[model samples]
Target chain A: MYTRTLFIDGQEDYPLTNRKEVARLAGVSEATVSRVLNGIGPMKDSTKKRVLDAAKQLNYELNAVASSFARGRSGNLGVVMPHVPKVHLFSTYYFSELLSGIGEAVRSKGYGLLLLFRDPAAEFDYVSLYRTQRVDACLILGASAIDSEIAGIHRLAEASLPFCVMDQRFEHSGLSIVAADHEQGSYDAVRHLIDGGCTRIGFLNGSPQYSNSQDRHEGYLRALAEAGIEPDESIFYEGNYSRTSGRRAAEAVYRDLGRLDAIFVGNDRMAIGLMQALREKGCRLPDDLKIVAYDDSDAASFTEPPLTTVKVPFYDMGRLAADKLLARLTDKDQTDGVINEKLQTELKIRKSSGN
Target chain B: MYTRTLFIDGQEDYPLTNRKEVARLAGVSEATVSRVLNGIGPMKDSTKKRVLDAAKQLNYELNAVASSFARGRSGNLGVVMPHVPKVHLFSTYYFSELLSGIGEAVRSKGYGLLLLFRDPAAEFDYVSLYRTQRVDACLILGASAIDSEIAGIHRLAEASLPFCVMDQRFEHSGLSIVAADHEQGSYDAVRHLIDGGCTRIGFLNGSPQYSNSQDRHEGYLRALAEAGIEPDESIFYEGNYSRTSGRRAAEAVYRDLGRLDAIFVGNDRMAIGLMQALREKGCRLPDDLKIVAYDDSDAASFTEPPLTTVKVPFYDMGRLAADKLLARLTDKDQTDGVINEKLQTELKIRKSSGN
Candidate 1:
């Protein structure tokens, strides 16, 4: 019961060092010392006064230490992430690059990285983390554009806390966001396929809950319209941005392959899976079908015939988000303004795109 | 006991001030309060009820984080590792597997894991982490047997702090160590090669600084001696555990190809480099030169001729190390001794070893 504030274990607050000594000096049991030192609860005034006087005399770094993390700084940068069991999230190139970037910047400031995993579907209070936890600043990863998530982020914004969200977009919410230009990336990738004389292109994107996916969808549509090609909603597919999901979409894509000559995938994992599944279905790479993928993960180059991928600057995005949030924390002159940073993405044209 | 519904703080769930308040109300020691509240470690029923009643009385928010370390420690487990630029450590099979295990264990304990990267050659103070920072316990990964590292670990042991070293040996130092049975694995791998009717076997080893490498050397020599085949030191080669280093050994290995039929490599990375270089030199795998390597990394199976390798239980070692160190922190009566746990390893038979 080290001062339970709105925050859990008061996230950053350290309990008093030697409670036994203070209890003995106050002529009270350690429990009583604890109750009285809280400066609240059902403790009698005399007991509270005695404990306070003893604590003052002992001065066990209590005044400067207690509630410092909750109200002040705890020297930790909290990174909020989705808790997916058994998936070693960092093993993924996207997470590995992003985390390494955050680690580099956090190291420069000599700050500890506190990773907090929450079930994105569960009811978690994001605002309380800022109000009571020891985390001086926080950066949220993989935020979705869902109502519950938006409301949660809204609370954090309303409180005027120092935080930044990576990838996900909350337009006009005044929240700090660092992301790659996925819309432009997808547009460029699809245009390349069009330029290569591929008139019929299929778009496979992730869940619409992610703003990036929605942005990618818009880009895909824009590119097709600009080419004066009629939209083929029947050939457009949606995945969960997982390799398995991409594999699942292969059946649908295969059925419509006669009409579709090329496919643009949301991320490299999905592209790899799609390619693998397509190969199993006896489809020839770049001959019968051409492909383009996003994210450009390490596996992109290893895939058969390789992958023409859009390289999102996830590392730079993570670094920029952390840097801006950190500047808000340590830099007093830093004023309040919506920090909307959109880093550029590059195209890595490999053999898969028939280039 | 008050109802938990009446939260005096608007945002925070519970109306509790501190666990000391709950302890005072329960008329018990703070440590007893911690043990009962955690519901994780061993505790008496009477103590549990008392702590529960106290919590109910104060409307305290009962959580693992709030009261688990009421003794004033930062609720972080610092993971110290060597920092190499642009390497993306977590992307590697060894680091990714080990870290995932550590992450799983840490989550189960409701503690934050803090990653601290140190330049191996630069002077670093491990003791300051426990003394100044909030980290209650620590675990070191990829520690080498150097004077500086040993002295650094010695200081932590001298302080009698809760710490564990993963996959390293500090013989007779009484430091807690969790490592895989590399020597036995090497023995088994070599025996496999001998059982394949290879009379003249070459050995490609990593740097001897690591105790595991030394163990592998011993295992290799023992297997040869057991086979009554005179050990040939001239054909034995060493690398610095880099793919380039393994490639560097290919020239010497190629020159001795006429004298040797099989080779036992220290790790998959080196084995891969050797295989790639040997292949470039027009050496056919298994048919021309049988090979056995250690550490069945992700790339092990992806090689042109998949490697026959030893699978070290790095994940299990990491999980066990974290679990043991975490227990020592929460368990008051837990006594310390030389904790040396050696997990087993398995040999995977693939195309590279004439299997």
Candidate 2:
């Protein structure tokens, strides 16, 4: 008889036999069974068959979600992102990293992620998950400049639903926010460009609609003012935060090329686009033009010239946000100062910026 | 008197109200107010304010979910994906397209999505959702060659949790499945590659442990057999269907560069990665290394040499899965189908393969 121990929710449940049990029955290890599972590990194919045959005789239930729920937790999380559907394709790499961070955080917390794309066009309500109680709490990703999202969170608070916002710099009286210090990060990026001896700089701004975009623009101006260089309004161009927009902005700059020697791109996607445009125009990076982009996405590192960009602490943000939400949920009268956590961004100097 | 029309659980309740009765609300149409309440059309900022102020003054309660629930519908459909913790950068595109499909499908049905991730290390039971009454039905994604998922679904079936699987070529009894015809798609890719005058072709396969991967691999062999070429063992490599693995596999192929003149990558991510690697080595695309990839994600068109890939009916898969689950949920006895839906794949030829 094969016997294996398995956790059902938090309690032990006995099943007929799993590969682990088969391994136990054969006086081997689970790793040996894993080899059979993948058909790659060092176990002979014949031994793998014996383990499988032993397991076939004993039926085992391997549904983790059901077992976890039995332990008094659904092992599920409610993740709310701005229901802006158009933003995904243009900015996948950024959100991909964010998802990776949140996924890692949730897994550590012994929970699985349940994505809730709050349709911006629809009523901003968390009731779909809240009323049914599918998740323990919510993590709101990129909740910046969207007033309705804040309003929705306020409603959640009234309903006693716990949630924490990520990457949004807001000083609301009772809101919990975890974010990267974009102003300081932007300040550092511009300072690096200025120190590299590029006086005439262009700011490729994202649409000033988003609060984070506004902060980055403000940071750019602050850096210029601190350096005693008058802010150049003529060099600033506001566009959508996309590679296509980045390419267009770079082309716009190139049409009047001599006026600007360096450009600060809003995001890495746009930054890569801008660099591609510059390269197509036969402009040598760092020699002819200096580039500094924000958001060190996977594409940023793999760009033709490795990008010089600011890295946001997505992992830290996710963990801290989860912690904050959990804290607020447990403590009823714990409302005081807004739990605003600012993670510092690192300036990664690479070939594009002559670093 | 303030008059308001409240729709609760599909039952209309009208409370009579005058503009002065709700407080001296200025210059807002009742239609605009209704639109905002129903989450219908956009309203001017000032108009939105006047209506909200009036509603607040009248002490009107907004119950979005309750109304939907009153109709004996939860207005939520569950989405289940394999609990792979790592973020596939391209999943941003995959998810967006899928949600768009589901969104359109359920828009008329008045349902929202309940996205859940299954932990690969954890069990796969979905009975908790049923116990909590969170969603009506589930759409399972990425259940590849693993027969355990089928057994899990059978358990869910026993528990009366409706579910439908996508992208896998499984025809389990008493289950509904939506999948792309990868066998024919792979045949098309190989035929195209052969037509391009490539005799020695390399295959960047996905984890062969999967049923879909096995089907695609079999298709490749079938195509080779049809072409009267001996299916060489040395030209195949298995990898996780990601860009990084694609690049690594390309590098492996580059080490034995002259043996193969073309490559067929399992997914778009891998195809893009392989293209980048080949480009880095100054290998001319199509002219030197013709390529064909699968899953025409957004990045496919944006690759250096735009990818020539197969477009899976991703949106249709999502929709069909939703429909099947909904059918089962509406009436259990009505869900009698070995619904083996094989959606067609479109061959998108672009600059990468010199199309």
Candidate 3:
């Protein structure tokens, strides 16, 4: 009720200042401010000028949120992530990093971050984080989590909240995305290894469910095929980008260790773990077996022999996503269907790859 | 009136499933369901049992948010991040890492993430994000963009929202924080270098204005003092936690190459830059000069010879801060002032430090 009376008469927007406050500041009557705003029986044009000028100087954005609230449309961002067990928690740095970028992007444009972690709740109750008037937008990361909560998210989207996905390309969905050129990065990493005299190379792949993982795996396989080296199934092992998984992959290679001279890991986390396992097994880097990794994470430089890795353009992806979201929020008619941009990755050649 | 009737009947905590739906499910009349909820018009206990059973089967948490909206409070986490220029707009790692921990912690407890970036809007105007009525708590990351905006945050805190700062300890009134044990991390880095045949160690520090940076510097000095080695003022260079600063610090060391045997960099970003500069200047890890860094970031392990750095418990800090915030939210009587927990940092030894 108070907010209604505070609105400027005949104005579609909220008042820059309440009548009582404006009257006190400009030494004018509340009735006069109302008359000036409504254009009803205005005194002098100069007096009206005084009130209008004061409102302009206040620089109010006209309580768009309040009006939205009245319409049951809350402007917020719903971030849904997998609530994995503790051992698998830190292993999901990719999720964390991407969310951070998304959070930064949306918040800069004056939106909110609504985080949802899926756990074992009663059927259909888990995805309720997006059901209420909490977020106006959603950024879903990784496809597996989306699968589990697709129904709930669909309900939210139907309620007019814009939703997007990162790092994955869905065939049927119209969700926007900002992803790295993981395939190119993988290609470059393998090529670097080949150029450095690595004849027999091994591949440690991430989970096949994630599209990015699949893309990286394809790149690795293609690079091997193009180089006229028959892809070795024994040389390939699937990992989930965790240190333990990387270590296991290394152990799998060590079980039949004579032929491989280099290894290409799916991510830096697993690469570090693989390197650690290799070091423990008395293998020297670049001398016995060289290593290359994707994601060029902070831990890559701290491995026993620094790894050669591909650097994801996280910073650029983050900024681009934010800019895109801001552009979407500001322009109503700009529903240019899901703009998919792939930023380039840099191949950082370190000592592990014999560079 | 419906909510009021439910409250009068002591069924306010029960969620809103239409009486008709309950009746249809329970094979009862709408009046019977209402009588069961209201406890006024006589209804059999069996009928009440059926209605209560139906409500439980629906798996609903009473929409406390809708009620809170009526009371003018939004239950959301207000996250504050500095908008750093010349850097990737999105902090792929920072947000990903922090939110993974925080998102998991706040997931079931029902507080959503309310991310707000500190835009360069004359500092005072940055607080306008809170005017949207979407945030109930605040999570402030340590950075400069939001440094000048703390006053606005303070104003937000006064408006009855809880705020928490991470990776920083501010002396500001009414601020709660969870900071890393940078001092311990620095101590470990310097001690490791000393143990590795380094008598003259150089320090590449972050900005002194940052409380964490200052703590690290003090720790470096303390380690030197403990070893009866007077710190060489010329060897200590102030740098931002960036690669450019690392390169600058490396250059300074290279100008007087023989004076220093080891260098300790502040963060992994700068450490990579410093290592690049050292490598360019024909410096070999542990052979020409030993290197140790703080934060033990993903990129650190991938440097030329790999870095030996101290690990900052960043993820742990995020979890602890969230737990603290949640504890406060659940029990208002848990106000025991700022609970300062200094998580331990491990010194990860690698080839760069002659490991």
Candidate 4:
């Protein structure tokens, strides 16, 4: 079904400037030349070698950009992240793990990764990436359900773009999401603290803008309700999931230290900070105030008392997001519905939780 | 100067299938159309608006891939990192900080970041990235001076490609290198320990394959010589820059704890591990084992006793590498000679060094 462009050897009407010239010299069909050059379909070794040799003789370099445009594929996957000034996203265990997973998957598939950062406060056109044909598919990370963020998600969904949000969720049914069950993870951690003879337990949470943080908060309340323990607002502290914030939260909770027996922290970064701050204040871990945190990051095992935490499997979530997006890109017909994959989180019992 | 393809209305000889058609319809020179469409060079707003409006009227969507091929610039930078299975490179504080700097610089330049990973143990051609015209420039990260790795560096140098090695030094003068002064940083750390009344201090270093490790080891020896103390090889432990290795090193030194008054760790990851392991064994920090570590990472300040460490400006190094590469790409004539920039490191005195 390919149209052959005639390139007569001595005719002035036809110029020897296209793939047809290579095909003619190689004594192969134009389709074979296209397939061999693009590495798209299966081809015999002899035929492929002949086509390559012909192109080499003509010194015909393949224009990858032209070929990509003709094939309607960019061979690149886009990863959009939030850009916060002075805050190095890579320094955080959360983002680095997700990116590693995405990078691994994209590399294995022979695709390039195009990383772009979007300022959360600035107005941006996320769909312009696909409209400009810069990426075949996209994966969004660190997205909150803010007005602009949610609008961007809806735009992607309406455009029918192949994308998956890593560790972020929304109310839209058409959106694809890959995240850990933070609520259940949080519940399990709190329940573990209660089972360890802990009453009047405090909870340190991140910002409520993130769905995971909201879910974790809900889980904390649910676990407390189940144990017939009345929740006290005074013992709950809100942090921004940063070490600095964790230290500040520890300071805030120190006033009520006499009333608290245990505490559940949002993430390992904050947990590590809290532990250090409490230690500096002469509070003994597991003896004065036991602690349970989430995202059993690398720092968790090496913390002072080896933190007990919820292993959120961030790397797996990243891999699964890329896999799902790639699967959709490869098989559009079969993978039409919105796929929401929530990986399970395991509670690792370490010494810090009085285990 | 621009070539204008001839076309006749209602003539079967000419096909309206190229950028020439868009140029002709825009009533502007082909150069202006090319410049406006590619977003290159300054242009009058009225002229740009006219050209864009004309393109829209003609239903012409700019094929960026084809345009990139025609212009001979991809507007992308390639970042090649080492790929280790099951090991997330981003989870480490070292890489994340470097990447954050690189990302910030790359974004400010309006260029896309193309990330790729190469297996350290495998033989691969690094020049293929430039040969394929996939990136305008390249940056090599996490590279050691192994035979193949060194050969790849030479290949890029010989090819005269605009590239820089982040935090890796080579014997060749033709290479562009950006790294921290690890030797001086290590010397300062050890000297600080000695000044703090430490007589017999241990050294826990990473693998010798990395140049930083070798520099750190030299600094350790130099500091001991300056202090008029004989170096004891028996107290030296080799690690792989991991917390697990640090923990093991601590275990090995536990038997000789009575003989040692202080320890110098290569990086914070290993130092944190060492402290945790020693603390588990009933050794009090500072009082029992005064420790000095490298890389004042976020975890360092939040460690149990708030580790005292040498601050290697990884973010600044990354930014400098990117900035150097970008400068060469922009002004090749002025930036011809190889540039080697070594940023100074500072010792952050905290509680861990008994300060």
Best TM-score goes to which candidate?
A: 4
Q: Highest lDDT, which number?
A: 4
Report the C-alpha lDDT of model 1 over B1-355, residue by residue, as the tens digit: 1001111112133333466788898899876775465433334557767888887777764443233223345667888877777666666667767877887788778677878776666444565555443467888887888876776788777777778888878754668888888888999999999999998999999888788889999899889889998998898999978777899999999999999889999998888889878988999987889999999975676465778999987777788888888888778666465567989999999999998
Against the true structure, whose DockQ is highest? 4
Q: Locate the minimum summed-lDDT window of 10 residues in model 4 chain A.
A: A1-10
Which ranges in model 1 have alpha carbons more than 4 Å from their true place? A1-71, A250-260, A278-288, B1-70, B190-204, B222-265, B270-293, B299-308, B335-338, B351-355
Estimate, for each residue in A1-355, the C-alpha lDDT of model 1 and write its tens digit: 3445444323343344467788888899976764454321234557767877886687642321233432345567888777677676656777777877887777666666777665666534554444434466778888897776777688777777778888888855768888899989999999999999999999999999999999999888889999999998888898988778988999998899899889999998888778778888999998988999999876575456778999988877877887787877767678476678999999999999997
Ordered from best to worst lDDT, the candidate numbers read 4, 1, 2, 3
The residue ranges of model 2 lying beyond 4 angstroms of the native Cα positions read A1-77, A85-91, A107-136, A142-161, A275-288, A330-337, B1-74, B85-100, B103-110, B121-123, B157-161, B272-288, B327-340
TM-score versus the correct structure, for each prediction: 0.77, 0.73, 0.74, 0.85
Compose the digit string of candidate 4's lDDT tens values, residues A217-326. Answer: 98999999999999999899999998889989888878888999999999998888888888889998879899999998887876778899999888888988887788
DockQ of the candidate models in sequence: 0.16, 0.07, 0.19, 0.31
Look at candidate 3 and tell me the lDDT of residue B145: 28
The CAPRI class of candidate 1 is incorrect
All candidates: CA RMSD (Å): 10.2, 11.1, 8.9, 7.4
